[model samples]
Target: MAALTCRQVGNDFFKEGRWREAIDKYTDAINLDPNDHLSYTNRATTYSKMKNYTAAIRDCKKSIEIEPKHIKAYYRLANSLKMLHCYDESLVTFNTFLGFEPNNNLAQNERTQVKTAIFKEKLQGAQVHPALRILSWANCDNDPLSCKARLLAATLEFNKGNEDGKNRNVKGLIEITEGIMLDERCFIIPSSINLAVNTAFEQNKALSPTLSVRATILKYKQRLAQDGWDSVLPALATNIRAAFLIGYMSRFTPDVRNIDQGIENIRRAIELASFATEIAPVATDDINSIDPILKITFLRTLKVHLMEAILIKYKRNIEMIDLFDKVLQLAKEVIESCNENPISTEDTISYCAYYRGHLEEAYGAIGSAYNERSKFSRGELGFQERDLKLLLESVKNYEKANEYFPSDDPKFALFHYLTASYKLMIGGCTLHEIKQHAQKAKECEKEAYPVFGNYLGDIFEKSMVFQALEQLKRPNNIASDDKYFLPQACHVSSNSEEEEQRFIREYEARTGGTIAATMDLSQAAARANAEFLRNGISIISSDKQ
Candidate 1:
């Protein structure tokens, strides 16, 4: 009775936020009855409130010792450890708690928080070449982090190795096979967190660790050709990244067998990303709910879709009308999304730049698609009117792309060239109109000549299309039938085999090693926001940036 009275007094003191008084009362309760588990737990709560997590942990352990099944003792101990940044221990404790009360949402959320903390810590510590770091994690047991890391690494390696002329030694195929095997392992995590705990505690339980690396890779390939997104862990961000990487990489490869697979993967990424944007938080007042990663993923997904459509056009896998319709639909969706999510003060300057770049790319892709459709429709009877209209629309979209593109960027010269090409392709244009477009093309050529000359000298000098544009600049050389110039103008918009190779070499030279060295800083920022939430602070209110 005396111990109960002391505990009640301590509770009242705790309620009043009197930390010292509460600790004194709880100590009295402990003195009255040393084995009282509730008293120890109450005292631990007081210690935690006082920001003395060490003392709280000690008392929590004592309470659990006195009463093994005391549930609050486990909760208090786990939270105290989390406060101390003892994430691994906290994760184990939370798992033990969930073992007793499996349906407790609070405990489940806390457990996920611990896992996220562990993931973020590991990601920070494992900073190196993204592929190497991811591959290193893949070599570990089949935990969630290891599985996701392997997938990310596989994609990076594949991107690095896709171009045959450069980085052929990156061994992307080996990493991709390993990633698929681990993806099979990821299927095990969603059923029960205990499976993860068991895999962590006992290495032999995991299948990947037991098999030889080559055997494991072959086994996964034989068992499953391609694992669907549904079979993997249901993390939206991870799925988006995986689908984008796999799809984008597969499509760009020269292998003919991979084209269909690549298109399927890209479509899956677009579907997932579109769904994510639809559900994203729209209330500007609640900035904490917004995830910038989702926005980035959506933009990248759109870019991939555009790339795939262009590939289809080049490959002639689909009819011209179908290609035009698909690209126009995508362009409409992208334009709408861009208008709805206009850049605000909350967005970083780099994010705004990235967003604008994608917008430019999107418009440019639309113009290119329209131009291709017009080219294919040119000889068809009763389609001349439609073809001319398509060319006009292509010119308009190219102008919009130029508007979004940064004027000082070297790539702006390419946009100017594309715009001039489409403008000159317009039928029935007068000599004055041809001369105007020719002047703009000449100016862009002169501006880009110095920058691109050394790298692209031979290709530019040999290009007949450039020579035609140079002739168009002189009114005296204007042919009465400008139809002869149309074919040359068309060639200006598309890269020749030699020009494409030179551009790739120039790109590699300009961005050497930087791509491998750079990591996604946006993900780091999101992790910081998540950490703030874990600490019970409003991320928006603590705007340190």
Candidate 2:
């Protein structure tokens, strides 16, 4: 009874963010019931929170010794070890936790992170054969995150003309593309770029070229030859460049919501995709080759980008009906193409359905924005009753997309996250529904990370939950004259230097710009390939030591 009272007090202190008080209370509980694993684990957690990792590790190990199955103890121990730079021990402890809770994606993600840390450390120590290290990660209990690592490693190996490289590279290429189609801003881009560079450099060197790394890197500047058959590598590179451009538009554009540059970039991307398709010349028998997936991603990406641009353009010219119809046509084509494919995966089908849902959602949002234009001085469009009707249509399409994923798929989490966001915007959700969806979205992210790995799209899910929770905090009786949706502001800047400066300031203020600075967003295909090759080899070398 005394131990229980102390533990309860400790939990309350912990919840109140009084770490030192919580630790004292937990220590009192441990003194009262020395064998109680919970008391020890709780104290260990408090220590971890206090950044006393050595003491935390000691307490966690004692708790684990008392109760081998104590999951929380394992977690605290691993986390503390990781903080202490005990990468190998942390890796083992995480594996121990997974032995009992195999399906815990949170644990899986943590473990993958530890593994990556270990890999980077080893690479720094001049450990050669990156493919071998990647294989170890890939074969780790058939975990999806490890499988992705293996695919990337194998692709690099194949680029070096190592045995088993051809088959692994082909398979890795396919999987990486699939990952990009699902979400563009994952770790897939960097891995794929690294692999492509090694392969291209090696191939270039074999053709009357020296094996020297410097000579190989120079090959990245050379243009790809116009082969009669459109090989997968060149086509894949085009798609990657296109995806990067779209991301650049979103991230680098002036915050005044100016999207003219974005629109031009999208047009250029579409032209690149079209040219790649024409040059590839797929035979009837090879229809299943990169053609279907590449075509589908290009069309869907184009539709989404075009719709965003159209929404911006619609503010200036309400008569963008023709352009809107064209985007709608693109959406339909994506859906039809997915259904017609003989080898389409369930994931592909779900993606196509999700794309269609976005089309409907965008249409509804634009209508709502147009209707609420009176709220802003720049909007000349008038609202109609049909605009509300379109919003309802948007909700229904989102629900339909959710159905396409079923419960087992990772993408299902994304649908729930998006649906919750839309529901919040639509203003009809009860507090209970909002809470239910927000929690489910969080759980879904935890579930999906082991499968798809973390993505930039997950930021939207986090924002949706944050916004929805803020809405829930407001009183029900609250009333405001503000419109639910308004057209974006007009940002017309003629001076390129001023526009660039404004964008840098706004973007840094919004996202802190630290991570953005680290990401390589080169527009030139040859340059990206070359840079990766130069850095890839240098990641681990004897001379570095």
Indicate which candidate wins on TM-score: 1
Candidate 1 segments exceeding 4 Å error: 1-234, 274-289, 296-320, 344-346, 349-355, 377-386, 427-465, 472-545
The CA lDDT of each predicted structure is 0.52, 0.50
Across residues 2-62, which tens digit of lDDT does each residue of candidate 2 receive? 9999999999999999999999999999898999889899988988787666678888989
Please provide, for model 1 over 393-457, each residue's C-alpha lDDT reduced to its tens digit, 9 standing for 90 to 100: 77788778877655433345555555544444443332234335445555654543322332223
What is candidate 2's local distance difference test score? 0.50
For model 1, where is the 10-residue window of minimal lDDT? 181-190
Which candidate comes out best when scored by lDDT? 1
